[model samples]
Target chain A: MKMTHKRRDMLVGLSFIAIWIVGFAALTLYPLIKTFIFSFQDVDITVEGIVTTNIKFENYRALFKFDLNFMDLIRMFVEEIFIYVPIIIVFAMMIAVILNQKIRFKGVFRSIFFLPVIIVSGPVVAELFSQGATTLPLIEQYGILDIVTNTFPESISEPLEKMFSEIIFILWMSGVQILIFLAGLQKIDSSIYEAAAIDGASPWEMFWKITLPSLGNLISINILYSVVTLSSFATNDVLRKIRIDMFSPDEGYGYASAEAVIYLIVILLILGLFGVIYLILRKRSVRMS
Target chain B: MITTWHKIKHKLIGRTITEGILYKVFIYLLLTSIGYIFLFPLLFMLSNSLKDIDDLLSPMVIWIPSKIYLTNFQLAFQTLDYFRTFFVGLSVTLLPAVLQTFIASLIGYGFAKFKFPFKNVLLGLVLLTYIIPPQITMISKYVLFTDLGLTNSAWSIIIPASFGQGLNSALFIFIFYQFFRMLPKTLDDAARIDGANRYYIFFKIAIPLSVPAYVTSLLFAFVWYFNETYIAAIFLGGQVPTLQLNLVSFAQSYTALAAANQHFFSINEGVKNASTILAILPMLIMYFVLQKSFVEGIDKTGFAGGE
Candidate 1:
């Protein structure tokens, strides 16, 4: 209770250090290593027991095997990012700008938009965001992609129609971005806006120059978070279906792990790319000042 | 008229209500349009709930309820396993929420108050853990729980949650760390002079002051775990159907209600609406009450630390 500062400091440091290390090792590092190792070895998950045998690079090969169609799995992620990421950023920025403006019931709009983060799974809040609600209505109104191909040129309109339909579904998933944007908007200093207005900057110009630049850090975070979330949303039902369609026990369960590893590697590559990009952006921000 | 630029200036400070007739009308319309977007879904869901089985099942149920059918409420509840499922889900949700929040706070306090070596390293690992999808952790967590014989039991959720690995916990630690830093260190110093130990200081001096974080964390964890999918879905899918999982039945049944009408429930349109209403009733009620604190709690998280 009444010890020298040095003794107290030593005691606190030692105990805290021990807990931090042990906790991290048990909770995080162990799982990372164990799971990585498990990816290579054959593990029977279906039965009551499993055996771990070194399959070497066999798992990796089987992932790309003709029957498994490993490339398609990667393609799913690529296709997802191509169509989904742009839509998320654009819509989120738009909503944030509106909310940032002086408006009545500002809090109401923020909460409604932020609702998705709380209930991302449609099934959970079936009351609020029924899976069928938005997507179904849009498809109904537009009559799906079939309507497009029927009425318009196949080459020009077909891809656009498909992309449009996909985007409508993704909008239901933008709750997290909304929250991040709200945080970002709160951080933008009012003095900057004042300076811009004094300089006779139009609202549009202000948004393009000051608002977007100020949101750089948050935009980066939101983008990374959105990508990670969308990928994992590879629904359990989807995984189950894939397994049932492709499961072959005697083949050592190599192909699926290979597919998992491929996606894992792809994710790592994306994160690495993002890390470099963030450093560059931070440097730019520093230099701009 | 000098009205064009004059109207724009008022909006910059926070908009002026009294303007030229044209400007006033313009402001009203713009406000209405934005407000309409927010109200659209609520209105849509409402009308859909009212529609009769025939119209609700019809793809035409897109705009309005067409023919109101109040009975849908009764049926959806039955399909959702109303009383039994809700109670089980509620009981399961409450306990884990309480446990998870306490553990998260403990971990958060540990990180915030104690000046530990490898502190940054530990925090970094937690940040990296966010990158690791919970889906990826499934098989490993499953194996561990199964080995401990916690499969399909309450311990399955509670034990892992206690480890402070849950996102809710880590985020709270980030939040709590900031909140703790803002608190004057005098409380701890006073407690030390009083011969109080760490546990005593935490519970008596710190926790009493951290009520906002505690209440908000409770609400956050409860709302989240209540709606949680992966862990509850895979772990308790067969044993105990949580509130979220129970809605799956309607999803399957409603898959092809009215092909042309899309969302129009087949013959049981009323049941779908009722199910939706019942399932979200708790969330809606709770949201209205703690809606202020809940939003503020999340917004407060790690904000005071950034500066």
Candidate 2:
């Protein structure tokens, strides 16, 4: 009877996880496997379904083959990382730090900070763009995407528009990060700060030595979450192009697949690089510990 | 002479008077300023949503409208089919949230009460889900649903969650687990000695004692799902009418992003805000109604304690 009951308990847990397995497999696992398979196999997704008899590693090859357009895609991704990431981090950090301070009306400020978490996936992206289009046309008549996007083609007239869409990407996603930071800040023993002050540590020094050092774990999570979240934005040059490709009338979906695979590879590499940096930082932390 | 006198005053009374006064003034000015900064865009959107087409196109309303054009809300409602969307969204959100919370509590109870093998492994797996970005599996999950022929069905949204989302459930499980574990093992021991089975003890003693946690998980689910549309967008593909779908469809109609203006999205954004306010009002209302419980829940849950 005990054995039977043990088996029953095991089955329940197995069944519980199995449900997640199917969801994860269907939503993520299979799509991930299919992306690579479809990338190599010249197949039209909209018409001809997944047939993968033919395969070549050419998609990966062409990604780094180094044409001007290819290089431009690479450059655009980097420029975005440089321009957008810092602005988001700095502004979000500043806002979070300020909000973390002991201020009156804390609850209202907390609500205001968390507002963006609720604003995901709506007409907001488009409205933000159209609003930008008005100003971007004026900016393009001068040239700002040239500075930001790096390759300011005279062909692309709506500089302000592109920047506007990009700004929406940059500005909108800080609520969770602020919360994470606030959580991290709150975790620090108040006595540590009290003692530090009693020992003559300045705010800047304390932030670097005590506060930031302690928040290493959260900072890594914040960075990872922020980066992953940016993947959904329509403004991600690669993702944007791939989406356009998927929706295009005359679908050279093979090429589009190639672009998408290449984009995924690049994203994976970026994530990998971040992971390495985090690992190194974590090791150094361990040594310090 | 004035500067020197000021410096001396700053030195003597500054620590108390200056810091206190400065903190008060700064808190008021700085916090409120930041509050306005955070609030302006939303307020801008709310105001813009109400403007007449003529006003919408004008250089700016920049301030309160001459007349409150309630027509936008009417158009938004009609266009987005807000009534239908609201109810469906409520059910979808409520089911997962409740189920997740309950399961978390049960699982938490198990972890806390019984000495189960691989409990640590199970807990670790639970924590791992919190880190894995949901996007990684989104497309694959959609494909899975497509294969299961559950596409565009509520099951696609509901069933996976019957298992659990790592959101409140996992965290709640830990919270519940911790609280249950912290309870003197004597309670369960005494109940067992009285011939109570695990289920009876769970339902009778363990559960009744976990009201704060129940409320925490309840509110967590309510708030999280109230505005949640990420999976809804992918799973339902926005062809169906959930609240978010209503908003998206509304936004799409009005949007010029699509080659032609659909007018659908424009209509939607207007009513969507009204719905947005409505959708969230319950959460804020819940907070007000259970302000004490909400604060206590946060304390017990340790949700805000650390990263």
**CA-lDDT, candidates in order:** 0.63, 0.59
DockQ of each: 0.30, 0.21
lDDT of 1 by residue, B162-251 (tens): 666664556656667767777789988887898888777878888888888888788777876777665676666458767677776565
Q: Roughly what TM-score does model 1 have, to 2 decimal places?
A: 0.81
> What CAPRI grade goes to candidate 1?
acceptable
Please give, for residues A67-87, the per-residue lDDT of candidate 2 as tens digits: 347557656675555455556
- For model 1, how does the per-residue alpha-carbon lDDT over A1-289 read when each residue is reduced to its tens digit? 5557756765654553354356456656676566667667776755657667887776666555654444654655565565677788888887777667666777876677665455445464334443444343445576766767778886556545645544434665676576667767887898997897888777777887788887776777676767776666534233433334224665433344444555666777777776687789778866875
User: How does model 2 score by TM-score?
Assistant: 0.73
Question: Best-fitting candidate, measured by TM-score?
Answer: 1
**What would the DockQ be for model 1?**
0.30
> TM per model?
0.81, 0.73
Worst ten in a row by lDDT for model 1 chain B:
B12-21
Q: How far is A247's C-alpha from truth in model 2 (Å)?
A: 6.3
Candidate 1 error regions (>4 Å) = A1-24, A45-48, A67-70, A122-132, A136-163, A166-169, A234-256, A285-289, B1-46, B57-63, B190-195, B250-270, B303-307
Colliding pairs, model 1: B56-B264, B57-B264, B58-B261, B59-B261, B72-B270, B73-B274, B76-B271, B76-B275
